[model samples]
Target: MPWNWTQAEWPNFHYDRAPLERLEQQFLVASGEILGAVRHVSGEDRERLRIDLLSEEAMRTSAIEGEMLDRSSVQSSLRRHFGLGVDIASARPREQGIAEMMVEVYSGFAEPVTDESLCRWHGMLLSHDRGLDMIGAYRRHDEAMQIVSGRIDRQTVHFEAPPSVRVPAEMRAFIDWFNRTTPDGLSPVPALTRAALGHLWFESIHPFEDGNGRIGRALAEKSLAQNIGQPSLIALAYTIERDRRRYYDLLETHQKTLDVTPWILWFGEAVLEAQQVTLARVAFLIAKAKFYDVHRAHLNPRQAKVVERLFRAGPDGFEGGLSAENYIAITGTSRATTTRDLQDLVERGALTRTGERRHTRYRLPI
Candidate 1:
C-alpha cells in the first residue's frame, strides 16, 4: 500500500554510523589475518590459491543463479587468463565469458564504477548465451519488471524495480555517489561501508533486464577489492547460496525501509564468515605445496597425475585409497604396470599400501 524505499519522496537512506564503522573495522582485521596467513605460503601456492579462490567465486556466483557450470571449464578459462596454459580440457563459450568478466573486474579494481563499464560486464556475461534476447543493454521503457516466483496461478511478488524511465537517471546518481569523495558534496563514508551500500543500491536499482543478481554480486566484489587493496578470496556468493532464503528476505525487508543498517550488518557478517571458510581451505594449498615438493622429483608421469587426484579428493579421498584399477584408468596404464608402479611408490615411501593382492590400494603418505 506504500511506496518502496526508492519510490518514497526524499528517500535518501541513512544508517547508524557507529555500528557500520565497527563492522568495517572487524572486516579489515579479518582481511589482515588472511593476508598474513597467505604471506607465509610459497609464491606457487599463493598463485594457486588466488586462481582457485576466484574460480570458486565465479562458479558459486553462477550457481546462485541456478546455473551449474563445469568446474574444469571454469578453471581452464582462469588458467588461460593467468597465462598458465589451459589444462587438458577446453572451456565452453559461457565459461570463457564468465572467466573473462571476473578477470576484468579484478584487473579494473582501482577504476571508478561507471554505467558504461557495467554494461560491458553485462555483455560479457550474456555473450555465450545469445538467446537471452538482450546484450549489455538497459531495459526498454515498455517492459514491466517484477521479481516473481511460484506457479503462474499462484504467483508471488517479491519486489518491483523502479520504472524503466527512471533507470538512466537513477544509475547516474548512484555512480556519482560511488565515485565522489568526502568533500564532493557528500559526507565522508568508510570505503567498506560504501562497498556494502553500493551493493544494496545497485540491487535495488535492478537496472538490467537480466543478469542483475550476478552483476550486483560482482559490483560488491569490486567494492571489496578496491577497499581492501586486494582481490577478495571471500566467496560471499557461496555464503548467500548456502542461505539464499535469508538473503532474499534481507533484501526484501531493507528495500522497503529507509534505514539499511540491518542489511549492512548482514553483509559484513557474511563476509567475515566467507573469509574464515577461505582461511580453512587455504590448508589445501599449503598441503599441496608440501606434497609436490617432496615427491615431484621421484614421481613418474602416471604417479604424479594420480597423486594430484588423490590430494584433490580431500577428506573424501577414495575409501582405502585408489585401487590399481582406478590408477590404470586414470593413467592409461596396463594392470601389470599399474601394480608395479604402486609397489614402487610404496617402496619409495611416496604412498602407503593397504590390503593384499587385487584388494590392494595406494594413497598419498602426506
Candidate 2:
C-alpha cells in the first residue's frame, strides 16, 4: 500500500474542527489555572520546579526511543545551562546533549522555526553518537528510510519516507507550512491543532537520519509554547512514554490516511492529560515548601536527611513507602536509632506511619 505522502493530497491534511472546539477551550482554561498557581511559588521553589520538569522531559523523551539517562547527570547539566549552579565537572555526552536540547527548546520557543534552528537541535540531540552517516543535517544517503519491525527475513514495513532526493524540497515546504500556520501567521491554526499537524507532518518527512522522533516532539512543545505566549510547562513526552504502544499505533494509523480528525482528537486528549500532570507537579511543590516550613524546626539531622530523600521521589511519594530497613540504609543509623527517629517524625506530624513491626512504613504528611 502507498503511504499518505505518495498520494495526490499528500501534505494537504484535512480534519474536522468541530470536534476540537471544546478541547481547545479546555486547554486555555487549564493553562490559566497553572499560571495562577505558579504565582504563589517562591523564587527558589520556582527554580526547582523548572529544573525538575526539564529534567523529566529530557529523560522521558530519550526513554521513548529506548535510551535511558542518568537523572542526576541530566539535572546537573540543565542547572549548568541555566546558570543556576554547577555540581559535577562533566556529564556523559548523551546526558549533556539532551539536556542542552531541552533547555534550548524551553528558552527559544518564541522564535520562528528555521532550517538552521532545526539542524542545531539535531546536532545537540546526536552529539554523543559517532555512528551516523549524517549529523546536524538532513539525510543524504541514497536509500529508502523505512521504519520496520520483526526479524530481517520477515520484517514489516510500517512506513517508508520519501527518497533522499526529495527530502530537501519536502522539508522546505514542511517548514514553511509550520511557520505559516502559527497563531500570528497568514493562516493561523488553533494551538492544539497546529501542534498535532506539525508533529505528524515532520515525522512523515523523516528529514534526519536519526533523532527525528525527539526533534518532532520538541516541535510540538514549541508549538504549544508559541501559542500560549510563554513556556508551556506540559509533560508531553512523559505522558506519551506512559502509553508508548498507543502512541506508536496512532502514528502508524494516521500515516495511512489524510482525514486526521481522530489523530487530532487523540493528540488533544494527550496534551490535556499532560497539562493536568504538570499542574499536580506544581501543587506538589507548594505542599513541599509548606511541609518544610512547618517541620524544619523539629527534624533532627538524621530525620531531615531521610525526609529530603523522600521529597526527591516527587508527587508519587517514595516507592512502597519508606520502610525501617530503607531508613537505616539511607541514614546509616542503627536499628534502634532508626526506630527512634521514625517515631519522633511521626509524633511531630512530619511523617505518617502505617503497618506493624516488619511491615511498618512511613510517608510525608502531605
Which stretches of candidate 1 lie above 4 Å from their native place?
1-3, 6-11, 181-188, 297-303, 314-366
| Maximum-lDDT candidate | 2
TM-score of every model versus the real structure: 0.83, 0.98
| C-alpha lDDT values of all predictions | 0.80, 0.92
Model 1: lDDT to the true structure: 0.80
By summed lDDT, the worst window of 10 consecutive residues in model 2 runs over: 84-93
Query: RMSD in angstroms, all models?
Result: 3.9, 1.0
Point out the worst 10-residue segment of candidate 1 by lDDT.
181-190
Question: Model 2 segments beyond 4 Å from truth?
Answer: none
Cα-based lDDT at residue 206, candidate 2: 95
Report the Cα lDDT for residue 208, model 1. Answer: 88
Task: For candidate 1, write residues 1-366 as lDDT tens digits.
Answer: 233545555247778888777778888888888888898788877777777778878888898889988888988998898898878979898888888888888888768878889999998888876566668878865666788899999998888888788888889888888777321325546656776788788887888888889888888887776677777767788788888889889988877776788888888888878878787767666766777778789998999889888877753478767998999889998988987888888888888888888788777765
The alpha-carbon deviation from the true structure for residue 61 of candidate 1, after best TM-score superposition, in angstroms, is: 0.4
Q: In candidate 2, residue 56 scores what lDDT?
A: 96
- Please provide, for model 2 over 1-366, each residue's C-alpha lDDT reduced to its tens digit, 9 standing for 90 to 100: 778899899899899999999999999999998899989899989999999999999899999999999999999899999998898656678999999999999999999999999999999999878999788999999889999999999999999999989999999999898888878898999899999999999999999999999999999999999889899978999999998899899999988989899999999999999999999999999999999889998888999899999999988888889999999999999999998898889998899999998889899887
